[model samples]
Target chain A: MTPPSRFDEPWQAQLFALTVAMSEAGHFTWARWAEAFGATLKAMGTDRLLDGGADYYAAWLTTLEGLLDRSGHAPVDEAAATKAAWERAYLATPHGQPVQLPG
Target chain B: MRRPFGRCILDSGFGAPHDAPMPHDHPDHPHSLLPSDPALRVKALETILVRKGLVDPAAMDEILDTYERKVGPHLGAKVVARAWSDPAFRDRLLADATAAIAELGISGRQGEHVVAVENTPDTHNMVVCTLCSCYPWPLLGIPPAWYKSDAYRARAVREPRKVLAEFGVSLPDGQKVRVWDSTAEVRYLVVPMRPEGSEGLDEAALSDLVSRDSMIGTGLAGASK
Candidate 1:
């Protein structure tokens, strides 16, 4: 039988892919990623019960943000601003219209 | 119109040539942006990296395909089947799991170092990564949701018998349960004993009986019909 989807959603798999790709490209070692991920899991704590790995992926995103910040690749503020820009651009688009950022 | 380069204008530390300008910066045509959500955040990250030349979308697609399709438990089942049918291979697997697994052209990431613990009539083995969801992705695809759950990670080591019982695996009083804690450097794959009445089966047929849970030590191989 086919195994269940490894990731709950498409974004989770995308994040997983990006992280592994970047690491493989020599941006950072896999060990470093594992270490930060483990540390992130610890800081996330075990207070809440399982929520189908939402919390786990949240921690993964947080760890990626930190790694990017430390590597001087993409500062946290830059990523946040980019996300905000996308948020605004999409909001400005009309219903049934494609969203495009101002050039 | 997408700018070839020199859009973000930052010297990415990687020193690789930039792939393209940010997806949103140019907007030559009307492109739909996903609603502002968690997925959009990931898209935003991808956009930034693409602009910086740290990663490209094609590479991301390839990596995603590798994990999603090419790698998984069936590979591990093949190894388990070989170990069961060939005594010499079994000894080599127990003696040096990493090399033996690599012999089957399966070695990468979390599976770089593997230890194949044998489950005998006396001892049972289970694997857990208490730190996070560190799993042998190259062997057993992605871990099940429960493996990454807090309850399993916290309780598996402390109460293996109880957890096994919940999985419908009740052991005899004389059987010893051994829980192996997986780490980034090393992972454990349980080599469950071949089921009885499966002696005449070939490796290909025997592999059909190796469930993902059986390799993880949560369940046993199905009895041969």
Candidate 2:
């Protein structure tokens, strides 16, 4: 069997690094991030078929968004709006093209 | 920070439940052609944080490079081999793992508090982070997906031998199985018993026998290359 990559996806690496960088930058302490992540894990429950799959990372994203919102670094609403803009921009961009956010 | 599943009191008008199934695997967009939902979401967050002067993309890139290239299980293997070769280092590792590991130039986040559990003839030690996937990232780098799985978190502490059997590790009945539950505050590294008939081998050769799972206590070290 093939070995698993350090991260399953590029996005996973991005999320992981962003969390570390933010914590190092003092947006939130690693302990606080751990607390938030643990709470998210508890809320998600341990009965799912997911094992560090999309569902797991979904929980991670949820925790990150929540932490940023609470810390006033990036409110959830603003992130959501920006995400929506990205979705619209991506859907409009043709296949095989980089999805650029509207200026 | 418990996020209520349906809608949070602090809803940001996104409307969807916080735990709603992610559209990261959307079928319409080919996996190779388009970025997944999570990727786009990350991009959005990074863009916003960068604009707000709260995050530096370059710094994030450097961190990613470090994890991807500079850190991994080999580092943990070096520690294990050293412990196998040097009794004083092994004692120091067991007594105060964080400081001992620092002596080897291996210390970083998620590894500030480490405890080395050595396997003996009568005992075997395994580790799991039931809360979250807390692991020694400085030595072991990113944890395997299975290490963070709900199945492992729920079962490793309940029936450790059974879980170990699933990983192809079946200990003798006389050997007691001890499972360690790691936390954000403390992580664990399992130093597997030195394989028999390897006294002639050098430290580097011994290190090659030490696999990632051996350090995590899920597998035995290889007898030879």
Candidate 3:
């Protein structure tokens, strides 16, 4: 698939960036995710969360953020920053119109 | 808050039976003769909360308005677009939808194990979450208010063709209507066929042809004339 447009809407851009960042950091790998999530569930005693699977994935995303932070490739904060930038751009643009991608 | 109850009492005329035909028996009426109007009921509940100083009226209106506009169609269009543009991808979507959809970079909370079923000349497909509104969020986004209603869920599967007809979608008599029951484990999206005269359209144009109801299998994609 073609690279996601830089001008993608806030949610679209965030999704694109998260996918790319996680893939690059190897956090998207099922093995890594399963291990991290399993460990988190074990530590947190799964009972604390309402939906076991949802909670596991939420914990997995948290773990991924931390891992990306430690690796220094692209810090977790950078993800939030990117998302915020997109959100601001989206708010500024009119509704029902596609955001123009930068060349 | 008080108006609906007053109206209900006025309409009911203090339990006096009238000669006016019941709504359920009326051929033109789209909905059943249920005593309660869901929207009005919700408004009544919110009015109570507002009266008790729990939630502000403006806040409630804003929340409801945002939900009505933003959340559902955005995701539904994307799924329809993807299906129209990619046949190989569509095949995979029909085969093992959950994993296939995730490949397209759209899966998360309450969205896993999605299945896309096709409607053909001989068969038509519709979906309902019997227990609750378990929708394929990765594709169709949030389930609409009507989708979450017990009236819809209970009746949809039981009278598939009838429900579809009420939605203004009638399949040919020979066509077999297959109602897929959605559960917490697996949700379904209807992969409607590309409309006629839409053969040479680009992806964006094609996406425009897909409606939220079509993706949910309540209606078909409009044919280009």
Candidate 4:
């Protein structure tokens, strides 16, 4: 019962949760999300980018995106577009406040 | 990216068979962490994952709530606290860490190969994955962003004392600093020394003093020196 909130930000917590949620809900059936993630990373042609290896959530997001798209749910680039919109919202939002996507 | 399971393809948590085929065309940026802007990419991925019925928001909320309410260093702290209080379990942990940790029902994937290294006043141990961010996820959960940094991965082994200094951990000249390099097969978790005057503290209270960085050997338990 010591203090929690080990995650530094809301987004990190979100990514972790999403992975667990999706996995638990029986969505990660066909392939190892990790392999799917590797496949996504491989197909994205970012072989040159991962040399430094700093981003974990980035991998998670890519895996999630790949999973959804591979499962025939999301269209390719939909995640990318959403990502851009969120960036705009985040840029516009004031500091110290939750970034909300503008309607 | 941090590895999932000893470089092996993970068992899809549930057993179902649907091709997780990815859509192509978002060409690589070739030099950055995210192929696109960080915030936008994360949000875009999250939104689409939910919208396309690939995952459920409610389950996601539950997972979020679990990490917020249940997971954290407390899990690791508790194990350390228990080991500190119970010598038998400590021995068990040292002898067979995976089984020792599972005794508390606190077991998961990355925990499969985790080895616990205790820090004594004479010997201080720190962990780093020179290859990738192979962390002990069962107890500590996901690693802090810094743990996954290339700077730490490369620097931790070359200059353990300097890294410890940057982390505000100054070991005496005579104190031996052991830097355990994590690999795909094994990861190390440092069990920091129990601070004095904590004898009266219960397991839960003792865990309160254990910080996440302490388990990683970057910080210490917040007990009076």
Clashing pairs in 4: A70-B21, A83-B40, A83-B44
- B87-195: candidate 1 lDDT, tens digit per residue: 9999999999999988999887632588899999999999998888778888888888889888898889999999999998999999999999988888889999889
lDDT of 3: 0.54
Model 4 segments more than 4 A misplaced: A1-9, A22-75, A78-103, B1-53, B109-111, B183-186, B196-201, B222-225
Off by over 4 Å in 3: A1-103, B1-71, B223-225
Ranking by lDDT: 2, 1, 4, 3
Ranking 3 against 4 by DockQ, winner = 4
Candidate 1 residue spans exceeding 4 A from truth? A1-4, A93-103, B1-36, B223-225
lDDT, residue B177, candidate 1: 96
TM-score for every candidate vs. truth? 0.84, 0.84, 0.48, 0.62
**For residues B1-225, what per-residue lDDT tens digits would candidate 2 score against the true structure?**
222211111212212325432334535754224356787778778878988988887778678767877889899999999999999999999999999989999887642598899999999999998888889898889888898888898899998999999989999999999999887778899999999888989999999999899888999998332
> Model 1, chain A: how large is the TM-score?
0.84
Candidate 4 displacement at residue B192 in angstroms: 1.6
lDDT of 2 at B113: 91
Model 2, stretches more than 4 Å misplaced?
A: A1-4, A46-49, A91-99, B1-34, B223-225
Q: Report every candidate's CA lDDT.
A: 0.78, 0.79, 0.54, 0.66
Q: Give the number of the best model, judged by DockQ.
A: 1
Question: Best by lDDT, which number?
Answer: 2
* Reference-based TM-score, model 2: 0.84
